[model samples]
Target chain A: MRIVLIFALLFAPPLNTKLGAQQKPAPLEEVKVVATTVLLGQLVQTIGGDAVDVDVLVKAGHDPHRVLPKASMLLRLKNADALIMMGLDYEHAFLPALLEKSRNKNLQDGGNGYENVGKRIAALEVPKSLDRSQGADLHPRGNPHYDLDPENVRIMAMAVREMLQKVDPGRSAQYQLRWTEWDQAAKQEIAIWKAYLKPIAGRNLIAYHNSWPYFAAAFQFKIAGFVEPKPGLRPSPRHLAELEKTMQQADVKVLLMESWVARSEASGLVKRSGCKAIIAPLLGASKQNRSYLTSMQALIEMVGVAHGLPTIQEFKRDAKEEQ
Target chain B: MMAPALLAQQDGMSQGAERRFDPAWNPAIGVALDAFGMMVGGGDGNNEANDSITLRSMELSLSSRIDPLAWAYTSIEFGRHEGAYEVELAEAAIWADQLPHSFSLRTGRYLADFGKWNTVHMHDRPHPFAQGVRQEFIGGSLAMDGVELHHWLGIGDLPVRWSVGVGANFAGHGHSLLAAESDEDLSLGHAHGANFATTSAGDFGLPGFAWTGRVSAQHDVGDNGYFQWGASAFLTAAGLSQEHDAGATTELFELGQNTLAIDLTWHRLAATDSSSDTIGTEFFWNQRDAVDETFDRVERLQAVGLWGFYLHEFNAHIGAGVEGAWWEHADKDDGGHWLSGAEAGRQVAIFAAWKPTEVQRLRLILAMNQPDPAAAADSILAVQWSATIGSHSHSLDW
Candidate 1:
């Protein structure tokens, strides 16, 4: 009786172990991807979902154009399976150095694991001929600030989805499902944004830099002129005097500038021109602008409030009450 | 209703259309020009032909990806020589994509991967003048016609990169192998006698081949700080040969030479503004072996140099820095006659630069040098203006 009991106990343990192993599903390893900017990182996260682990090189509130790649960032890139960048020379200042030092062949230009979201968008402000004499801050391919427009964000999301499917063929179905869900959400939000921003349409505005041409084009806002004399060139006294005349003639009442740009120049212009200045940071640059949807909503609300139109929040509340 | 119609129009225009790939495939071309005016005075109160304004250098550079596997770059420099414009090929190299097992190759005439300062061009250097050690040992821009193999070792989580190279005409005129006249040598003419006159393969009395290697490591110290350190070595069987018996008989003496250098750099970005601080230092030890004419025995001559600097960026458009350097030669029974008069010396320099934009810069430099043990110290004040046109890509400094 004792020998039979011992044999039963030993057999039972092995049987239980095999049963547990067979019942559990194998876990999928997430693909690692590195993005050059915060907005691109957020888009990659939204589209990639659980299929990818994303790392952003340029942190929030920092200028993407002036980011200096660190050694730790390169280390993260070394283990990444893919790299996504906002091409068109937007990251031209620092991305090239990081890519060369990473020594990761898969993430370099022409590599199979590389994707440029800017290439997917229809560019704006493209020059007929590019020369340094025109300006120091010229982007040869065109304005790379397309992400400021929600429509362009949708296009970028599609590019990210395609890249993920190509990199992880086995998980294409899961990526497609998530991409569809995100597309639906983005479309709904974009409709709301267009309605909320309608009040500010056809308004004359002034920008501190050449960073908002795509946004202006999308919203039907007529940009009077930039505060700077030219792209990346600081304004001289004479140029500033001429800009003041143009601003007054256009009846511009609001100045838009990024958070990183010095407010002194914008404030001075505001004082002289009797216009209000609004800090319109890029997406993911602040806690209020965390996600893609929230960032777009915030930008619309800021512009609407600046022009004395109803905020998106007020509109949504009113609509809900009417419904 | 109007908003929806407007958005619909935007949507119609935003359709994804494939851009012509061939039209976008263009090489990046850049031109950089530097000009400076200077006034120099000696403490001994003898100053003539020391005040002048001249164009320092003009560099034309072009780079492009040749294919999926390689990229090519070339830079040509034009400078004034004897009141005439002279052109020289500064750098022309092709680098390959890293292959299996993390290895890559670069070939052609290129600046050797030595210390941190040797790879940077004159216009880009923080200081207006080259380091005393760099001028005395490696010369300005230690370029060599060679093939370099670089490998990145994935050992632990630390970042370590290394390279090994071998080249021809390592001791030639254009390539400053063991010792050759540099652009600084031509410009200053104070350290001309300190360098060995073996400027070609025939002068070395041996096959003019040299080998160089470097190992560099980088570490991140805190959120916005970084540290980097590296060591480099160069060796060649080429050295200076002299005639015996006062030009009566020439001896076929084979000579050997080598150089060793170590460098350290620390950089920190300001937490509140666009300011940053960088501290860097490099030390060089150069040695040469030759048969002494009088002793009839092999003798080794050595020179040691140390240079250090601290640079600060006040803003996007303004920067300032200070640098100090010291060099010494081993005194032998021959009273160190092999070294130039000003080779063993020390100097201190301070500079400030104002850049209105990314492409234009104006800088002011104040320098004081104490050359030759017997000569009095001298001071120089220089104003430099620089401009660049076209695309510019920053290289991997590590």
Candidate 2:
């Protein structure tokens, strides 16, 4: 009997193994994925777990506004079963040509295969009037930069899950299961970030572009002003001088600039204002050996470090010192 | 201006000459009849009526797409003052291949690429609209018979696009000529003099030739939904002229003139779920070179204009929004005593449009334009109904 048991163990389980090895209800079909950036790639993967193949055209740390299509990039767009775009004219310069070349006319306007992530989230910088000349330049249809807000990311993820369900009805239940876990984790992380930010919520900061409105609104941070008076128009010496004077009055301690803008200008402002400058990633950044989550955590950690407050490192040091 | 053609022909067609048919070919038949009535209000000196309405602009055209690459675009227009019909856009040409950068070349009687707004000729318009100072200062804003080579390039991974064109006109520009001391305004406020007559036709009287070149660049960003920012510059010059009219006195002055214009436009298109926006700001300046053998100084006209619009579209079916235009010309003060009557205006317009479908659009626009209240006083309430029967890319008129 002992010899028989050893033989059975060497081969497989007696009953459960035989049933389990027979077949999967069916081999799970590969899930179709369409993403605008690498951050979405990570998020979808974390939730999708494995049964999917995701393709993102835009890399992290790249300016979505200026992303043009290469010949190779066109081939990738053509093969995608679905397409996800930031929408709200953020990628206007490139998306039109890409769609035309892909011969994907269905994705042009109201195609079912096309998904606009901005539609699911609220926008900032919405102008009161439709006039383009009302103070340099302003977005008449709210701000399209909702991606900066962590809460909005959750909303976007939910929309993505819904779209994925439509794309793969067979794995709808599995996708929901994974979505719940990922969304709950995201909500918990957001709460932790909110609490972490509570100490310096009212701090004043200056921005390079108008990209920070959504983030400022979420955290109750006051935006002192912008480096460029108008979008796309370079700030004249006179304008920069005026901005310096305003910065002194506002007592802005931090100069927040987008990574895409030339650092020399922000450096000039930092030198003139005698303030700490932070080159923050305006979009989902893909740093070497780091994901979007880690990049965002690094940014928040830097903010705490810039304030000269108790960083997580500092806290750990203090605890050891107390010990 | 004809020198480029001769040069190109001499350059040897065997170099890279490929025989290809134009993609923009259309053989369609159309019939249109238009009648307009305008009211004149408050004229003091030599006015016929205090308030009267009359036919303003009416026209009919027979457009023919002769071949794959060539077209025969002909139109006849009737004016209110002259009360006579004349051929307006009687020309033919071909649109060549578009480059990968979205730039294309054309050899035809098309309008000279000048102002952002003037590229669309009046005869092509479904209704009559007033041209701005930049358009008015530049001759007819119409095409000179010539061949133009154009291209677009980006600025080092930025969202900026540069459009450049080099070409020559079949006829010289006439509006740049200055009036002589003997010139007088006729009863119709029309300057009947050597300047107007010679400039309208040119010294050869066959309309002299002119050399033209222009460079325009626009950088757009997500300034707003259905709105973006853009700026462009254009330059045109009447090159050396050989033919001179001995009988006409104004033709005796051979001064090559060049005009330059720069402007910004903010444009936006929105739908319920999606939106597109572009904002552009422009500055324009024109200079008249004194090719005159006489003691005339080079004159210049400088004007600044800001034009932009924001549109909130529920969908392609329905949308509403507002647009604004503000223009001011540089002050001109010479020894001459009569007021130049240079125009400046600020206009704010609210408009609503209904698109029954993708191809048909009905728009209602109401604008209050204050055009040089001191010099000329007139406010217009214009409504337009625009529609298309076919694809946009296939039509040259848009």
The candidate that achieves the highest lDDT relative to the unseen native structure: 1
* Local lDDT at A253 for model 1: 78
Docking class for candidate 1: acceptable
Residue A186 CA error for candidate 1 (Å)?
Answer: 2.9
List TM-score per model, in order: 0.83, 0.44
Given the true complex, what DockQ would model 2 score? 0.02
lDDT tens digits by residue: candidate 2, B340-376: 3335544455667664433344556665444443433
Best by DockQ: 1
Model 2 preserves the real interface contacts to a fraction of 0.00
DockQ of every predicted complex? 0.25, 0.02
- For A118-180, candidate 1 gives per-residue lDDT tens digits of 787788888999876677778879999898788888888888888888777667777788889
Q: Report the number of the highest-TM-score candidate.
A: 1
Residue pairs clashing in model 1 are B193-B340, B194-B340
Q: Model 1 off-target regions past 4 Å?
A: A1-28, A69-75, A96-112, A282-286, B1-28, B80-85, B171-194, B200-208, B221-225, B244-247, B269-273, B290-298, B330-344
lDDT of 2 at A311: 68
Cα RMSDs, all models: 10.6, 20.3
